[model samples]
Target: MNRVLAFDLAPKKDYIEYINRGREERIGTMKVSDDYVRQCEKAKEIQGLWNPDVGDWIYSYGSRSIEKVFGEVTMRYTKVWLPVQEDLQAILRYETPLVMLQAFNDWLYTDSGYGCVNGARFHSMQELWLAFVMWERFSKVWDGKDWKVV
Candidate 1:
């Protein structure tokens, strides 16, 4: 059985709020245009980083590849952690039986995208910790019974 556990410090709503609050501009202030472009170029250095067949239309374009490159490092784990915002939706869309940890106040996670899988919503870090404990207990119970989880 392959078990994948993914977590994020805050939910998507916080991300949306931060993004809307000019967090990008704050980060951008320290970055030079030429340097940023170089960083983007470096992101595309790996092969099959994005669906090569799609050409440039790849979701993140150059940026997506950088994430993919790091994802490759954990390719052998049979489970991937996508604690970041936006990407989790993409992962759930493509992968089945996903375990998603959401926050009620989070704007990014809608009930619509969560398909046939396990999902838990938390209002605080304490709740999130409880969810993790529950997940571990459930996993142990299922594993003891020789149930297959993927």
Candidate 2:
């Protein structure tokens, strides 16, 4: 995974955990922008990365699509968004920035299985660090057509 911004530290609450928490709590408060939604789209494991639509098959991760994930979130949740700019300064503020970053990167890789922390729980900080490689190699504009091309 490619490193974008390198910070010595992170914030008290990582956005990933916040997202999972909202999911677990059914709070419907975890809202993300179209950009983040796209990022989440890239995070999913699509069936075919290159092939176009076919019979009884398409790019979908079970029920993990962006629409289903953010379906319950409304305008109230949208208002609370902090707006993570191109540099990703907003996410780096978390307590363990590297771990968070890596996890996001690994998640985006369709072949990656559960990233570093495989299971549903984080037994140690090491696991967080392991799963922190999911967001690397990501492009700002991923409309399933044009990605962040150099």
Candidate 3:
């Protein structure tokens, strides 16, 4: 099985963004560009895919914001949403409770308190969730064998 790392699953070019309606509205009112409407529509389009709830993690192209009321405020960044550990556990349990419990038990008993799968060490809950997603989508697990991408 090929080794897969947690960072390998990170988005290279695109990222998710949080749309603060009040802030955006005020900013939009200050400007004449149609960026606000476009951003809202883009967010809507993305949200339409899974019908995500309030706390569900979703993907986006990226985002930017302006700060410093009196100076030139230009800041751009990628806002990747990392799921909280409890949220991830709930999601996994909802999908397959027994399997999740068994996996958790196995990991918990390991000498290393960290979670590692197929040589991928997960330092945080976010990394673990990303690994799970990658494995579910692109990996295949053979009985008594390491995971490999199919």
Q: Evaluate all candidate structures by whole-model CA lDDT and list the values in order.
A: 0.25, 0.31, 0.35
lDDT of 3 by residue, 1-150 (tens): 322122232445322233443332222123211232233233322223332344433223343322112222223122222233454455443457778767655654554323443424433334444345434433432222233444
Q: lDDT of model 3 at residue 59?
A: 24
Kindly provide the TM-score of model 1 when superposed on the true structure, using C-alpha atoms: 0.17
Candidate 2 lDDT over residue span 51-119, tens digit each: 221111111333222222222333332222222132233334455768655656655444443443443
Weakest ten-residue segment in model 2 by summed lDDT: 50-59
C-alpha RMSD of each candidate structure in angstroms:
17.1, 18.0, 16.5
Candidate 2 clashes: the total is: 21
Please name the candidate that would achieve the greatest lDDT relative to the true structure: 3
Off by over 4 Å in 1: 1-71, 91-150
Better of 2 and 3 by lDDT: 3
| Tens digit of per-residue lDDT, candidate 1, span 24-124 | 22221121122222222332212212232211211133222112222223232221121222322332332333344443223233332221232333332
Candidate 1, overall lDDT? 0.25
